[model samples]
Target: MGKTYCHPAMKQLKDQQTRYAPKERRLEQVERAEQLLGEIDRTKRYPYDYLCFRITGFRPDNWSALMIEGDEARRDLRQFVEDLSATVRQPVEQATEPVLTVDEVSKKYNVSTRTVTRWRRQGLVARRFVIDGRAKVGFLESSLQRFVAEHRGQVERGSRFRQLTDAEKDEIIRRARRMSQFRSGEVGLIEIARRIARKMARSTETVRLTLKAYDREHPDRAIFGPSTTPLDDDAKAQIYLRHRMGVSAENLAVEYGRTRSSVYRIINEVRAQRILETKLEFIGNESFDDSKAKSVIMAPLPAPADGKAPRRPKAPKGLPPYLASLYEVPLLDREQEAHLFRQMNYLKSEAVKLREKLDPAKAKTAALDKIDELQEQALAVKNQIIRANLRLVVSIAKRHVGPMNNFFELVSDGNMSLIRAVEKFDYARGNKFSTYASWAIMKNYARTIPEENYRRDRFVTGHEEMFEAAADNRIDEHEYESALKRMQEAIRGMLDRLDDREKMIITSRFGLGGASERTLEQLGRELGITKERVRQIESRGVDKLRRIAGEQKLDLPML
Candidate 1:
């Protein structure tokens, strides 16, 4: 299900027979594609309209500009040229179109006969016929030219093929690391690295590894973001999440300021990644392959109809907000559990089947897109299963809590185990998923939670895991809190430099006296002015305070 990590840049030509065939010289089209591939500068961005004009000679209205990587655009275009020749090139009169045997094409491309076999299965037509001496099994030369137009591995490789200098690696890594600060949280770090790889005419892996090596060397400064990075996985994952929630790529494109195709590209990339990453190990059943398996086993089970998943349940009386919110999703019934498990496994099976048709070397966009759709469907089904079972993690974690085990930490580990069990559970065996998940959660808690820490009694969430591998910052809680105390103590006197209104605004804006910081609007409401005016006064007060701090040598948080 993991798709080829190709940026979407190709648009299928309309009734493209003429362009692909081209006045009895289809071979020339492949040559044209090769030329176009060479002309591509991977670092640059091309708009949809420009790409259409360059590849298909027709510019449409309102095309996206600079939305995808130059290398991916070239890759997709070259693939399309080859696919066109492979799928559409008919086997004409044998005498008219010169024959090229599988061996001959393989030798020419330095590929194995196996590769050509895959090609033939995809679309290239071949025939067994008598040739000069006896008989030869070969496809039309025109077909070979059209279909075998890809030149991927040599150029699109990583460090294995390319030799980048230290300076070159450093530049790419530095730019990439800087981008990772904000972009790695979700925006397009992978896409950006690919662009640099193309721009430098290096393999994409070269850039990827350069960034990775830098990250390994500087673990704290890694480009993938802070450990709490799930808030934004990637633009592709974000787009997929929204799309699963019923947002169309076209509308999302508008919302995200990308071309519709780019949005779809992100979604497909994420979906394919998820499917490929997931291990769909379902227990096989004879009924699974039955002709009526889908209709019967996959029949709509008794559960919420579309749009009927449980809403937020009201907070239970006399409970803390955190614990109460845990009850938002209702538990699933037996049939619903069976339905979700079957749907999840079935969707994965179908995706894996479709994945057989997707070759990373030459992915068919339409097929990949279909795989994405299936992946999304599977994910939606899997999520329903997860939601119905999340509370179960918390329930079991409570029993296993110990002196060393923080409840939240145990719950986090148990939740991960639950997700894994869901993916690994076999619905065909007719066992309840809850039982399997419960076992998984318990198994995870059986491990010892760390018994020692600098601050063993610190009441906090599970973020301490990051500190285990953190660089030698060495500053413990007391030292950090002591530093904060000093800053707070110093800030009290810094307010004296400001006038009455200025002092009030500064104090209120910063929550200096322990009341929650007031917003510009809130300050304006109290002071009888517009929020913008309040902002102006706050700005002046901050400037005066900064100057006063500089004059008095005060070290505060703002300073």
Candidate 2:
């Protein structure tokens, strides 16, 4: 028999058909087989013998089976074997290789097609083959598995992929609200954004947008106005105290919950207003006092409403009419005033030169030599100047009394200026000695007033303290000198008791006579002894000195 060939389902159908066939149908089957053979030859284009041989086991008796089965059975059997091979190959190939298409892999990995191409280019995936002129790409199963496992952590935490937790979303919402409020100065937007971003580990801008959305949804609770409010009087006072006490603005801002700019504005405004009010009040009071004094000096005078002229009193007993007329006279022409000013300036220059020629130090010595001859004249001149400028010192001291005291010091300073004015006096200058002295005294007084009061008390002003410290240093120096002299005397007395060799060695070694220390060798050579012997003798002499110092209850001098 020819090799039996059958599809499992087809074979079962054929068996059922054969079992139903009877002997009377055998002749009909034979006739059908011959007809089928004829049809197979026409359709399949095969010779009858070849087709019959393929279908049946090459036997003359099996010719009818061959003709009946023919190409239909052969075609079915070939299809079944092909399908079985495909089924076996498919799972085997799938086990070793990836079944996913490039597009599918990209979607699975959450990456772009370009990214997948890049991975293939970088050898991250296996090279592909071309089928039917179309590029067919694939990856090894192990490679895909490893790639997925390696990047799983990155995928889970990727910015584009990861979802924010409830807390993070809430924080972002809060920040957005703050940003919207911040535009109106209602909230500290920067701080709020910063806090939210830190908690969420996100960018500040992200938090800012979130806050803005939150603020839109809940607009009523938005903060507004300035970040800070104006300080109360007590707060102002506290700030002033801190400023006066020299607290830094940075530190004050931290303590007061304000910015440096706010604190500075308050301090400066308060100080400036206080100073302006004080200066204005002082000027007003001074003007009032001046008017009162003028009224007392020239009583029963009519007050001038326009401030054009001084209301003069009736002439005093000692004044001549011409002198009074001169006092009241104003230059009628500008030329006359100019001429007088020129002459005054010339006289003033000459007077300054003459004043420079007189030396107070030399004058004091010269005055002693001719004391009896000039004493009376000097006393008379001094009395006249004092009588002329009665309140000169008081006026000079008043100008310096703003924030300082020490009236007597101001007076002594004025006395120096008065002496200089007297020496340089030029009556022809059209300016009196009192007027010149007034300028000099005022200049010196104003110059001495410090810009800042470093010392709290007038008695302990910086300059005074400096002088006191210098005087104290001088006293300390005197005490030190006294002690040093006593120590030298004691050392000298101790030296007298030493032997001549020891004395010379000790004196040279310690540099007692002059200001140079001698080496042991130099001292030893000078004394005609070995250096070692000199050292020994020097050591013994030191011990003896210590003993003598102990017996005399004296402290040995330090080296």
Candidate 3:
């Protein structure tokens, strides 16, 4: 411990050692290669190509040249081996952080590639760099830690965080009842919760969950009381009848202490049931029992009871039954019909005055209410008239029954046509309503026959022949004939607006002057001009006439 110091010679030795270390390492590698070559030469059993591959980790294309086959060329073979050793490169091991690919991460998490993609979307993983222009996903070990940390919390499903208390459930039920009453028996759980959530300082989900739990716990409870009770069949049928009589669903629900949804459900159910029953009754192949069938069929007049005059069968309920069934609608006498017509005229006048005074686009609520009221009254009057003339549809339907075979089907079609006739009928025409309706009914029935089947069976017989003949031979009514005459006069007046030459050319060309139609060339000759010039004048005059006709509200399809 007295003096542990390096000498001057030791310092020089350390410098020398450092300078020769790299050269020494290179020499050792060369020595190793020489020993391997010596070993290969001794083992002649192994092919030279195989020896070069094992020693240098590469098989040269020309093993003969690389090996120097003759022993005399051992020096050249050594030189070749040296050059090969210098040119060959050893593979290097790179120090890199371990990465998990999308597939590997999916397997590790027991999930799918889609889940890994979702993690990337949620910023749980960083995008991996591309290799060879191809995109790849590789999550670093540290990124997985972030993913695990972010998704580690326990989660609640559905709308519940904890169990609902008894008091909370009772409160929800009470609020729901109040809401149903306020809405006039038109309440649902969601609607009730939306209204009560604010007052209770809770979410709609909480209120809904409480109510749901209450329902599960107390099955015997009244729940929403009368509003929640399902309607009976009698009540359903009455709802349907009233709805047909023009009551709104909202009003119906309020009157019946039920929800609007329940009202609509009841009405649809009854209508479907009635339709099914009707189809079952009418579409049967079973033969009718005479006594039962007679009772089912309605008569226009029942036989006198105890020598009293006969009376029509009592009016049926609901919609008029199928025409094959008994349904006697009360008819109107001349006096009653006259009174209704007078009332219609007065109502029409009042309605016209109201309509003239009101602007629908800018009307106030009161004006709209008045308009609706008047319309309803007018509709009621029209319905009375339609019901009175329903027999007319049946009478005509009976005449067409031979071809139609299904009497009920004919009656149904006739009834629809009769409704149309009612909508289109003009009381100011001074013609009988029956006369107008007959034409409408006959036109509909003519179209009712299946054209495909009618064409196949070319023969016409029975009432069909009579119908065709009547349609062909019937004369136009005086009202329509007079209207035609007025239309002709209007056309004559419109023509007079043109110059004398134009009027003469148009009248002669179209036979409008009660003469044979003259050709453009003939007119051109008479007028001493080219047919092209005559054609131009004719077009001009026709255009003028069309403008005039449109102004007069004439229904001219050709124009």
Candidate 4:
């Protein structure tokens, strides 16, 4: 229901009296209202008749009274009056202490601290005061009770409003109209609102709010115009065109006297309209789903007579599909190259240490096997660097791909030189990898052309002599094999001098003791000890073997 007021001063007086009323008087009203509700419930009489009879008691009815028929309706009225009376009495009980802290108010109302702050902003809260020299907000007991009573029905009904009667609203609008007339004059909005507020015996803020609401209701005829004046078709077109020509939103907003967001919104609307127009034109007489456009485009080509997938494009000469695919591998940045370079150095150092225990006679297989594993890991890091800088190789190779050298051959040779550069390139030296790799790649390409020319020439004119010269320089391959076998056997004999555990440690650490060489950590796991402990054992074992070999005067390879 809308608000009803008999008179503003009378209403104000009633509110003040309710706040300062005696506790006994408020309680007596609550009790009397309850008694009337009970009588209506027991007798099944109309609410208005009951109220009139109770007010007149034994007196006869003088005029026809408003009839409120229904138990539920009468009960609701009783409950509302009872709640209001109880609320009024509560403030009297707490008359000695009327202040409340923010926390206290939040707790009583079962709301968050933020909600309490918002209530204060919305003028729903009681007056604020300072406590303990700190600025704080406090809702009086009377104010809180009043708030609760006002909201009780609203809580159940959903729709709610701060009590403002139609007459009061009309008065506010009339004042707002007066302000609007004076708004374009020398009097500013603030001064006009203040003058109207004083005349109406209200706050300037209230007048300001009422004026703003009135303006919104009549936007075109508003005193200050609309909050965001919309763009016309021509203005929208200008925004779209200027934005496309690289004009910034800030400049456009300033030029048009609008916000940046407003200008951007207009531009977006124009673009969307244009897109829709284009799509409509395209769909004339026939239609297709834009979402399925990708699938439509990717409709497969017809299969061949052999019933197989189409063959891939030819890879570059001497480059298999797998190797060529590596070209697509992600390139490493400076940090990545530096990190990989560190790992490579560590692996290299470990490999050097393992090589010392390599038995040339019996441990050749084990030693070479482990060394190959370490080399493979080091090669992985090298390949990453190579993949990243491969573009450099291609650019250099492209310049030399002509008469004497094929593009593929130059690329392959350039790649090999690139790998060498990755291994030696020191990022700490502060030189870019591209600069170093470029010179190495170019030098390789230069040598490649001359070598190709020489090979072609030798094939054409001196094939027989070249074969004779190669044959004359050849050594007995079996003699080299036999000597290596003897050296491995001698090394095995030296290994026999150490104990079984020491021998095993030496073999595994160098790959001679196991199928593959093991890192100290790997050996420790297998031996059920820590890596540091494994290192100590290996060191003691190696020292013992070195001494035995020295005493024997056996020309053992450096261990």
Count of backbone clashes for each model?
3, 9, 1, 5
**Candidate 3 residue lDDT tens string, 475-509:** 66775667666766776688789999999987776
Residue 398 lDDT in model 3?
74
Whole-model Cα lDDT of every candidate shown, in order: 0.62, 0.48, 0.54, 0.55
The clash number for model 4 is 5
How close to the true structure is residue 295 of candidate 4, measured as C-alpha lDDT?
Answer: 48
Residue clash pairs of candidate 2: 1-57, 2-57, 175-211, 176-210, 176-211, 176-212, 177-211, 186-223, 186-224
Worst 10 residues of 1 by lDDT: 463-472
TM-score of model number 4? 0.23
Candidate with more favorable, higher lDDT: 1 or 3: 1
Order candidates by TM-score, high to low.
1, 3, 4, 2
lDDT of 2 by residue, 1-559 (tens): 0112232333322232333445334223332333333334214433334533333323233233333243444343333222222222223242333456677677877765655654542223332333234445545455566555656543343224334577777757655555655554333544566666666665444555565555566667543223456678788778867765546565676466565567766665554433323311000112223434434322322234354554433544543243344334222122222222233333333333333343432333232223222222333334444434535665567567542354445667777777566555544446545567788777766665552243445444332221012223546777867766776688788888999988877776666756365666566657677668999998888777777778887755332
Give the distance in Å from residue 556's predicted Cα in candidate 2 to where it truly belongs: 48
lDDT of 1 at 267: 68
lDDT of 4 by residue, 1-559 (tens): 1011222222222233344456565554444544454445433545344554452233224324434444533334343343334345343223345667778876665555655554543233333244564434455665556556656542222222234567876787776666667554445445666777677655555566676677779877666453356668998899878776546665676467555566766765665454324311000111122444434322322244455543444436644353576556545555455555555554554455555554432333345545545655556556666777776777787788654455666778888998778767766665667888998888777776888788887775531221112222255877666755665665677778788878788877665523465667567767777668989988998788677767866555444
The reply for model 1, stretches above 4 Å from the true place, is 1-283, 303-314, 318-322, 402-404, 450-559
Q: How far in Å is the alpha carbon of 241 misplaced in model 1?
A: 18
Q: Which stretches of candidate 4 lie over 4 Å from their true place?
A: 1-327, 357-373, 454-559
Q: Taking the tens digit of each residue's C-alpha lDDT, what string does model 1 give over 398-469?
A: 897654455666777888998889878887677888888998877666554443333455654332221112
- Candidates sorted on lDDT, descending: 1, 4, 3, 2
lDDT assessment of candidate 1 = 0.62
